[model samples]
Target chain A: MDSEYLGYAAGILTTVAFLPQAMQLIRTRQARDISLTWAATMTAGVFFWLCYGVAKQSVPMISANGITLLLLLVILFIKLRYQDSTDTGEK
Target chain B: MDSEYLGYAAGILTTVAFLPQAMQLIRTRQARDISLTWAATMTAGVFFWLCYGVAKQSVPMISANGITLLLLLVILFIKLRYQDSTDTGEK
Candidate 1:
């Protein structure tokens, strides 16, 4: 297969892979085993990746990381909400 | 900053990001809230990414994804081990 095809495949698969995680969190409504540090770290990492893509002018990286960033942010948001929901429930 | 630096930063940060996740799983000794599907999907995706790296002859991609694939495989192994541990505990 062409290298471009490989890049596309990698981009699509990796980008789509994050969906299961986000969906699982949403469906289960639990992230007890997931480290907040991991979520935050993944967000920061992917942000740089997106910026890297922009610098390289690679559409696949830019598009994939762009979507992945949004997904990670949603995951982060949910995690933050769930983490504090109990503490704030009484208020 | 150079695009090379951006690539390096993205590669380094993203590669290091998985360590916390693996550490979290090991420390907690629990995978209850983690999605088996996510673990599996991530492994497969990273495998393709590694292949993409090889095809492109990109040292950063190769090095980063290689480490990520190993980490993900470890995670998948643990998730598999945990998911069935109770059922198999009877033996």
Candidate 2:
């Protein structure tokens, strides 16, 4: 396969990986164990990656980051919503 | 800034975002709340990403995926290690 295909395969794998967590969170409404910092930082990071993809004109990067950004935002929102109730006092 | 710089910045942000979770996992020895499916799938996905980076000869992708893969592995290991003890019964 071509390198571009490889990139897309990799992107698909990474992007799909988030689905299980997102679905679980949506179903259970539990975000106590997840790190807020990780979610927030990842959201920012993915946003930058979307920008990078635009700059590079790479479809794989753009598509993957776009979807991943939405996933991260979902996780982040869950984290924030449940933040008060599920305090582990770690952060 | 150059597009390359944007790529690097994006890579850095995403890579660093994993640290907080990793650190917290190490400190608390708690993996009950983390999704095993997420960690395992992410590890596999990141491994593919490293391969993709190698194929593309992209320094940022290689470096970022390399570190992220290791971090995922750490999380996976923790999840597996504590899998029996802290069963949330959600799996």
Candidate 3:
């Protein structure tokens, strides 16, 4: 197999690996326990990863991390939005 | 920056990215809408990615994906356990 194929497989694996959490949060609308600090740090890291991918001209890395970043951001946003009123003390 | 440091940064970012969701679910004990199929596929993908990381001797990839796999697994397990029993129409 070619290196691109391997990269594609890696991209798919890493990107899709986050689907369950994203789907669950979206479906349930529950975001009380998510932490701002953790989310912020992760988001920053993802952004950097995206830049790294771009710097390396690696489409697989860019695409996969990009999609994963978007998915993760939504949950982070929801957590920020409803964390205070959820009464779950999750934040 | 050194390659090792770069890899370490990537690992930190990716590994901790899922913290919010994990913390939330564990705090709320709620897992009503997570899809078994999605979770299963993602878990499998993570496993493959882990193997890929290992084969490449990429500690950054391995460590990051490994931690992510654990976090995702916990959420998936909780979702499976209560997915059928919960009545939120999420599953």
Highest TM-score scorer: 2
Best by DockQ: 2
For candidate 3, the lDDT comes to 0.67
DockQ list for all candidates:
0.44, 0.59, 0.33
Q: How are the candidates ranked when ordered by TM-score, highest leading?
A: 2, 1, 3
Compute the lDDT for candidate 2.
0.81
**How far out, in Å, is residue A28 in model 1?**
2.1
Itemize residue pairs with steric clashes in candidate 1: none
Error at A44, model 1, angstroms: 0.7
Question: Arrange candidates by DockQ, highest first: which order?
Answer: 2, 1, 3
- Using lDDT as the yardstick, the better of models 1 and 2 is 2
Q: What lDDT tens digits, residue by residue, belong to model 2 across residues A1-91?
A: 6776766677788798788888878877767668889999889988998999999898878989999999888888988986566434334
Off by over 4 Å in 3: A1-7, A17-28, A33-38, A85-91, B1-6, B19-24, B33-38, B84-91
lDDT of 1 by residue, B27-69 (tens): 7566655678778877888888889888889887788999999
TM-score attained by model 2: 0.87
Ordered by lDDT, highest first, the candidates read 2, 1, 3
Model 3: per-residue lDDT, tens digit, A1-91? Answer: 4444554576686577557666766766764434566667777887777877777787876887899889779767766765565332222
